[model samples]
Target: MSDTDDLVEIEQLLARYAVSMTRGDVDRVLAVFTPDGAYSAFGDTYPLDEFPALISAAPKGLFLVGTPVIELAEDGATAAGTQPLCFVEHAQHGMRIGYYNDTYVRTPDGWRLRTRAMTFIRRSGDHDSGRPHAFTRS
Candidate 1:
């Protein structure tokens, strides 16, 4: 595929991830990641399998508005991107803001996320988050 084609595909992949997460569609979210994918954020490491459980714990009626900026590799086999996330929760907690740095790989299944490191930019409520740990490379 051409570079432009790959970039477009990468953007779609990133947007799908944001929408899936916003809707709490765990299966769809998992589909984006590699089976052995790692989520490194706030100095903690989590497996792709554990994400569903974690996200499920979030308060109900929460929505995330994400804007993603994608960068595709020359080989089209890898990609990297950043997405700023803004959350709207119906509960008293109000809004939350965060950023995600992601890495992706193109497999027979199409494009899948290899890693996602999320960083909290700001939040309406006081939340506890540690410093960023490992950085991601496409």
Candidate 2:
């Protein structure tokens, strides 16, 4: 396939991931990742097999994922991208903002995530968060 096709497929993969998580579909979520995929968040990394537990521990939320900025590899066998994320919690009506760093690998089955990690961009009044603002003059 061409580079455009690869990019589109990766984009689709990311969309599927968000949808699956929002729907609490474990199997669908796993399908986007490679067999040995690893997801890192909350200061811990969970292997592919532990994803179900991770999913279970996840809070119910609406995941609003932004379009990823993807870059293809020279050989087109791998790719990487970063996508912004916004999650609105159901119980507390709270919100969390973050971005996902994902590495993609082309498998015989299609494009799948090799690794996925999240970095949160905390806002003011957020619990356990540090200064979440731009520098200001005193």
Candidate 3:
């Protein structure tokens, strides 16, 4: 694949990662990562296998509504980007906002996440309020 093609594939892989996480699809989320993939957020870092509980406990109906800015290296080895996550409160339609900085790598199996550092810029309503919610990811 050309560099552009590799970039596109990496973006898609990152998008899938976001979707899987937002939808609380732990298995699929983990599949988007390399064997030693790492996720760090809120001063906490853990391996892919140790992240299911965190993903599962996240709010449902979550969505990522925005285009990601992706950057690819010439060798098609490392691709990184920041996805401005528009955190829409699922139930309330548009009640919250946030973003995540994501990074990926092109592996033999395709593109997989190497790291995902989430920064909750601003938020409203408890993400895990146990109340209804709606949202998507990109």
Candidate 4:
């Protein structure tokens, strides 16, 4: 596939991630990542194997994902980008805005997340009530 194709696929992968997380579909969310993938947020890192439990422990909410500025590697097997996200926590009655720094790999199944590091920019309303701590970008 061309670079453009890769970029589109990667963006779609990120979208799927947001949708899955919003729906609290831990399985689908995990599918978007590679077997050894890692997710970092609020100063904690969770490996793929432990991700499901972590996600399941969180409150359900609406997660809106913005388009990312993707940069494809020359070899076309790797890519990186930063995407803005808005999360509305129903249980907590709050919202958190953040950005995800992502690394993607062209796996046999398609583009998968290798690593995703999230940094929150703002939080409002019962923000501290959620399992994930409120954070600000430094």
Which segments of candidate 4 are over 4 A away from where they belong?
123-138
| Cα RMSD to the true fold for all candidates | 5.6, 7.6, 6.7, 5.2
Evaluated at residue 113, the lDDT of candidate 4 is 96
Please give the CA lDDT of all the candidate structures.
Answer: 0.73, 0.84, 0.69, 0.82
Determine which window of 10 residues in candidate 2 has minimal summed lDDT. Answer: 129-138
- Ranked candidates, highest lDDT first: 2, 4, 1, 3
State residue 92's C-alpha deviation in candidate 1, in Å: 2.8
Error of 1 at 15 (Å): 2.1
- lDDT for model 4, please: 0.82
| Per-prediction TM-score to the true structure, in the order listed | 0.78, 0.87, 0.76, 0.85
lDDT of 3 by residue, 8-36 (tens): 78767767876876777788889988888
Which predicted model would earn the best TM-score? 2
Off by over 4 Å in 1: 123-138
Per-residue accuracy of model 4 over 14-39 as CA lDDT, tens digit each: 98999999888889999999999998
Residue-level lDDT of model 2, residues 20-95, one tens digit each, is 8988899999999999999877666778998887788668888899999998999879999999999898889798
Q: Compared with the true structure, what per-residue lDDT tens digits does model 1 show for residues 1-138?
A: 787777777777777876787777888878878888977666787888777765675555555645577888878698898877776776676766777888989999888889988677654454334455333322
Model 3 lDDT, residue 24, Cα: 71
Candidate 1's displacement at residue 115, Å, is 0.5
Model 4: pairs clashing at backbone N, Cα or C within 3 Å: none
lDDT of 2: 0.84
